[model samples]
Target chain A: MASIYIDNWHIVLAALAIFITGALSLLMQLGLAKSIFIAATRMIVQLALVTLVLAWVFEQDSVWVVLMLLLLMGGFATYEIRARQKLAFTGLWSLGLGGIPMVGVGIMVLTFTLTTVIGPEPWYAPRYAIPLFGMLLGNSLTAVALALDQITRGAKQRQGEVNDRLALGMSRTEAMLPIVRDAMATGLLPIINSMAAAGVVSIPGMMTGQILAGADPANAVRYQIMITFAIAGTTGITLLLATWLAVMRLTDNRHRLRLDRLRSQKYPA
Target chain B: MLIIKNLTILPINVERLELKGGVTALAAPSGAGKSRLFAAIADLVVNEGEVSLDDVNRNDIAATEWRKRVRYVSAEPSWWGNTAQDHLSDDEKTRQMAVRFGLTTELFERPIEQLSTGERQRFGLLRALVDEPRVLLLDEPTAALDQDTSLKIEAELVRLAGEGRIIFIISHSEAQIERIATRVVNIIGGKLREGKK
Candidate 1:
């Protein structure tokens, strides 16, 4: 067995913690100081446990473990998206609509085009699996949540016009399509901006890591491009799926908005 | 049967009201809770008392479903979308209803923003009436219209009520109320009193 010495990790982490605490203090009152301390402590403990498990995952990783990790990430992302927005989708089908296709596309891009390491053993190496899928899943979750929130608010604000369309025999989903399309464009704007600025202004995280680990800049750039393309496609697909699912739940079979169940407080403050 | 029991409302401040579904004309000072009372029954206002239909508690019924059966048309005709046709459709039935109300097919596709005040008022009321609600909650439905349009809408209200729909109207026009309201319930300082015809 080989010994690992990840030097200066603690020092960097401590500095990050101090910075985070300073920011939290600026946001909270003196009365909330204890609550902030408890929250920070919990975050630290959880991250530490995850780090230990990831270390083992890297050492003896197999493809099965990678698949499980991806599913876990997607499941947790789905739950987090629902919790933060306080809205549920049509059903589990919507979750899979957003999740499976996205993670699958991301895996294909990472495995075939991006990397050189080819082996059945350690195929699900934490260093690669976690960071790659994490970025894809995290972005998909955020984009879906934002689109759903915006679309729901837009529909409510324009309820009169929506009802008019309903009176004209447009189904609830058809009535909401314009609003959904507008929201989807808004949700994709950030990623588009990032892509536009990717090479000149900023290098993305994965590309930066590969460069730091002695991979050629050109190769890293190539990998980053592929990942970005994959992410853009997956994100668009996931957002569409999530928005469709969320909006479908807003109506009943009779084709009217189930307004009483709406989580109105979830609107942006 | 919009049964409002122990109905307390606060449009500006604390106010209380109680009413049952009928041709009730609400008359009050501008800042009083007449509109608030209407909104309470429509489930638009954040109210405390029970607003029930028949023996069924509205609190148990989904507000949206309950609202579908009891239409609340605001005086300020909410202009949504870009055009008139976008606001309301010109389907065969809607067109026939428009013709019945003396509206032209041109008004159907015109953007609501482009419609005249009277046209918008007519359109708003038509939007509500088209649903065939059991109870019609009007927040001064003709407040934005001219005298002629107001009279015409008043006629439409009389007709609608005559067809057995429960109409609750909030109005300042003594003439209109006298002409149309089967029973006028005056609310002065948030208290309800049946006005003598």
Candidate 2:
């Protein structure tokens, strides 16, 4: 069966749902009516822009355009990760450490999915590769950001305990292993929870989108499963890499904990 | 001997202080930067100075190695892991030192959170001593202890010093300083002044 076409009037009619929600929010005095209106407007504008860009990109049929878009997404993801952190390392280390890993891992996982699983022609086909890489990059960015923030804050809070261990002859890496482990676990928790609840408590966004677009239910479920696995892999690898790089930046070659490199408040008095 | 030359820790300056292998008690008023001085000597904070142990410059040694040789114990000790035993080395000598410090063997297995402040302080000292450091920079090692416990720790520190270990202690009690220190120096307004008991 062909998917039903949605005209401009249909879109406007569909938007009434958001207005209803905003009205309910206002009546309830939840203080979220304005935010809901703004967010809904921004979402429509952003998605429209993305649609125009993707249409142009798909028509161009150039691998360079696809690669450039991927790079742009990765760069923004990196900046977001750094921005979200309370205690981040300065200079290129902050950008490169998390940004490079997330993009690199995203590219690797996307390439594998495109070539081995989807097996689409030209492998760089904008439709499959771009969307898949976007999903991976987005998820990996969140994971890496969480991991970086957790580890940096954890190290700062535990500065005394860490230094105590260092003074007791433990190397910098050895002293920081526990914090790193804790941060990694925290970073992976969101993805793990989402995976656990998928299809049971809620239908995932990708699967819902595919089903809405008139894809076969079985095919959509399979694709969702693969995407979830790719996301899990991307998040795990990116978070681990980011955490290790962050830990390295926080310490020195002489096995000293150089918390001075971070841009956060000093340990409590 | 620990020779500190031209040591300019911000707000605390020691022109030239030569400490032989014995107890050198540092007596200073509250907020006189005594702890900063200890941290500087331990290389825990940024400072400009030359601290050499037997002609070996501190910068020449790796920080870990240097810290292993010259250990610093703060006024409030930090412990990791659930049990006190987790921080202590598993060896007969450490066990013996724990007993000598009046910490029973069972205390080692007890949860660190359950230990009293004085108990934690002694355990902190024991943890440092187990490393067999050449230099000990202690900040009010017995400030939380009772008179009897303080005397016991003082005796152990004296014995450790008699064994030729370089120890720099920060103590406010004049009686305690007199009882243990071979040389006493007062730090006032970031300047070191030699005082006679």
Identify the candidate with maximal TM-score: 2
Candidate 2 CAPRI level: medium
User: What TM-score against the true chain A does chain A of each candidate get?
Assistant: 0.75, 0.93
lDDT of 1 by residue, A34-66 (tens): 676677779878999989878877765676776
TM-score of each: 0.60, 0.93
lDDT of each candidate versus the true structure: 0.69, 0.88
- Using lDDT as the measure, which candidate wins? 2
Q: Any idea how many clashes model 1 has?
A: 9
Prediction 1 TM-score vs. true: 0.60
Worst 10 residues of 1 chain B by lDDT: B11-20
Put down candidate 2 lDDT per residue, A1-269, tens digits, no spaces.
66788899999899898889889988999999999889988998999999999999999999899999989888888888888788878777878989998999899989899999989888899999888888898788778878888888888899888878887777888889989999999889989999999999999998898898989999999999999999999999888888888888998776767788888523220
- Highest DockQ scorer: 2
Q: Any residue pairs clashing in model 2, and if so which?
A: none
Pull out the clashing pairs in model 1.
B83-B110, B83-B111, B83-B112, B84-B110, B84-B111, B84-B112, B85-B108, B85-B109, B85-B110
Each predicted complex: what DockQ? Answer: 0.08, 0.58
Worst 10 residues of 1 chain A by lDDT: A113-122
Per-residue accuracy of model 2 over B1-197 as CA lDDT, tens digit each = 89998888878899999988889999878888998898888877667899998889999988888888889888888877888888877899998888788999888899998999999999988988886899999999999999999999999999999999999999988999989999889887778989886
